[model samples]
Target: MKFIPFYLIFTLLIFVQACGNKQVEENKTQREQVIAVHDEVMPKMGQLKSLEKAALQKAEELQNSETPDQAKIDELKNLASQLNLAYEGMFVWMRQYNTEDGEKTPEEVKVYLDEQLVLVSKVNEDIKAALAKAEVLLKD
Candidate 1:
């Protein structure tokens, strides 16, 4: 009877340890997924800055011209604003990122990462749109 109880305890302990290890592995995977999305989008930040600068210059030139095209200037201004917002969103997301809460678990990390993937996808799309719009405007 004593051996049976000890065996049950040992089995339970092993099961608990295995569960913990699985959670740790899951957390690592979730973290990697989040970082992957971030890495994919971060390199585009420089391009966004360049586009913003070009848009600003173009807008300034239009304003200084004898017959400024108000409509074009407004479009460029809007593009600049959107680019700024996209950059700001990335910066804010990085600053606010935290998955190490005391009460949080690996499941929570997975949930957070899943949500972040959607947000990062949208940010990338916005960056692409801004780049395309800026390119067409700068060409003219």
Candidate 2:
């Protein structure tokens, strides 16, 4: 009877261990997904900066013109500011990312990464929108 209880305990422990491993693996996959989105957009940071610079230059040129198009200048300035904000958000998020190594448990890491994924995705979208607006303005 004593051996039976010990065997049952061993079996339960194994089951629990298996479940924990599965959870850890799932968390790892989720973390990778988040990182994938980040890596995809990281390179675009430089492009966003270039767009900001171009838009600012266009704004400056328009503002300095004797017959300035106030509406167009405002639009360019707004677009440039949006691009800058997006860049800053992405940069700051990267700098503040807290999950690394085994610093956080699997569940904690997953939660943090999932939130960051949402934020980075939004930032990327903002950057793209600003770029498109700047492109149209530059073409004009």
Which prediction has the highest lDDT against the true structure? 1
- Compose the digit string of candidate 2's lDDT tens values, residues 29-132: 87787777778778888888998898999899999999999998898888888889878978887887665646776667667777877877876677677767
Q: Please give the TM-score that candidate 2 achieves against the real structure.
A: 0.89
> What's the lDDT for all of these models?
0.82, 0.81
Per-residue lDDT of model 1, residues 38-82, tens digit only: 787799899888889889899999999999999999999998988
Please report, as a residue range, the 10-residue window in candidate 2 with the lowest summed lDDT: 97-106
The regions of model 2 sitting more than 4 angstroms off are 101-103
Which residue window of length 10 is worst by lDDT in model 1? 98-107
Candidate 1: pairs in clash? none
